[model samples]
Target: MKFAIFGVGGTGGVIGGYLANAGNDVTFLARGAHLKAMQEKGLTIHTNHRGDIHIEPCKAVSADDYHETPDVLFICVKYYSLEAAIELTRRIAGPDTLVIPILNVFGTGAVMQEKLPDKTVLDGCIYVFAKRSGPGVIEQPQEILRVFYGFRPGQDSRLAEKAAELEKIMRAADIHAHFTDDIQRDALTKFSFVSPMGAACLYFGVTSEAFQENKEVRETFIGLVKEVEALGHAMGVTFDRDLVATDLRLMDAFAPGLTTSMQRDVAAGGPSEFSGLVSRIVTLGKKYHVPTPLYKKIDDWCKAHGLA
Candidate 1:
């Protein structure tokens, strides 16, 4: 499959590199030092579970130079970069293009569809511990990286066939890929973990391990999940399992220094997923009349400090 990865940071770099290494046609849309590095050398992936990977002779170009369309496109940039990414996607996304945005923010698929109505957009998320260690280098820890995606129910789009083909290609590259029957619920369920963890950790100025050690922090984490769940329910999304308890179990098993990308971005004084994760919760809470005290506290802090 001809794949275009717009924003080859951590998640995109790892997934796109794997496909390119598997001899598939993959093009990376990047900028700055990262683009230069990938064009000069290649994309590199460092992992703890799997051995290191280096994919040379990879195709990469900046937005101003790329014009060819692809069979599939993955928008892996942060929420703040979505506008620019969407414009770039338009330059390469034709009728046959299936755009899947692998982001931490819920409702990203809907947002993208609203912006680019002509393209096929699907809901998707990634479960992995990863980050861009440098311009051309990406890193993943814990050896766990899986992708979940599917079309929204009642939307008969031809991209479903392309999704199946994409799954086969991904698994061929040894990446776990699953097509969910209910993509909205899956996005919300996935958000229940990362969003709450980020709000809790950043608000309390601690790590995942610290949340487990402190009772107040633990309660706040659970509270944040409840808030998000209530908002999801208000939006007519059904969460079948005990997501809060499940997320707590995840917290228990978290590595010693595990922290959300939002936390790291905030610490580095860069743009973060705060607006989509924490501030979105608070906004939805108010819209649905759900009391989101936990997220509200974090939101206030974010505003006071200009973190968002």
Candidate 2:
């Protein structure tokens, strides 16, 4: 499959490098220092699970010049950057191209559908954590990587079949992909879990280490999770009520030094994704008449701390 990944920062780099290494025709749409780095030295994937792996000579080009129409396109930019990302995706669209947004923003699929009516648009929710450890180097947490996606509402079976094909392609690349019957619910459920985790940890100074030892902070974490859960329910999205417990279990499996990427951004004095993560939660709360005072408080703290 010919795959093009836009916004190859962390998540995109990990998946794109892995797929390209597996011999899929992969082209990364990149810009600035990252593109220059990948052109000079191919992307590297370093994993504690798989050891140091390098994908030298992986294909990369600036989005403006990537004219090859891809079978699969992964839009992995931050929600705040969605406008530019979609414009770039538009440049490579063919009638049969499938554009799958890996970002969790609720309305992005609709936006893509509006922009590319002829192309198949889908939504994906990924449960892997990765970061650009350095230029052209993607560092992944030592945990299972899961990609779940499906067609949008009222879409045809062709989209599902195409998603399954992409899933097979992913498995061929030694990556895991799960096809879900209800992708919107899957996306919202994930956002319900992630938005709060990123907000509380990034805003309230709750490091992963503290998330382990601090009882009150952990309970607060659960509170924010439940808050999002309630808001999701109000919005007619079904998420596991036991998600808190599941998150607790998942936490144990993560590296002790692991932190939310948003938290990492805060520490690095970079822009944090509070709008898509937390601010969107606030928007949903208002739309559904759900009160998210705790989330709001934490979000305000994030703003004060220069994290928002």
All candidates' lDDT scores?
Answer: 0.86, 0.78
Candidate 2, which segments miss by more than 4 Å at Cα?
Answer: none
- Write model 2 residue lDDT over 1-308, tens digit each, in one string: 79999988777987898898888899998888888889999998778788877888878999888889888899988777888877876777776777888875665777777877767778887877788877788887675777878887788557566777888889888788877888877877677666766876776666566666788777777888788778878867776457788777666566666678777776888666778888777777899999988888887877786668
Candidate 2 achieves a global lDDT of 0.78
Candidate 2 lDDT score at position 209: 63
Give the clashing pairs for model 2: none
Q: Write model 1 residue lDDT over 1-308, tens digit each, in one string.
A: 78989889778987898889889999998999999999998888988877888989879998788888889889999999889878887778999888899999998988888888788888899887788989889988767778888898776678787789889999999889888889999889999988988888888888768877899999888888888888899989988899988888878876777777888898898888889989988888888888888888889987897877
Point out the worst 10-residue segment of candidate 2 by lDDT.
249-258
Candidate 1 lowest-lDDT run of ten: 153-162
> Measured by TM-score, how close is model 2 to the native structure?
0.93
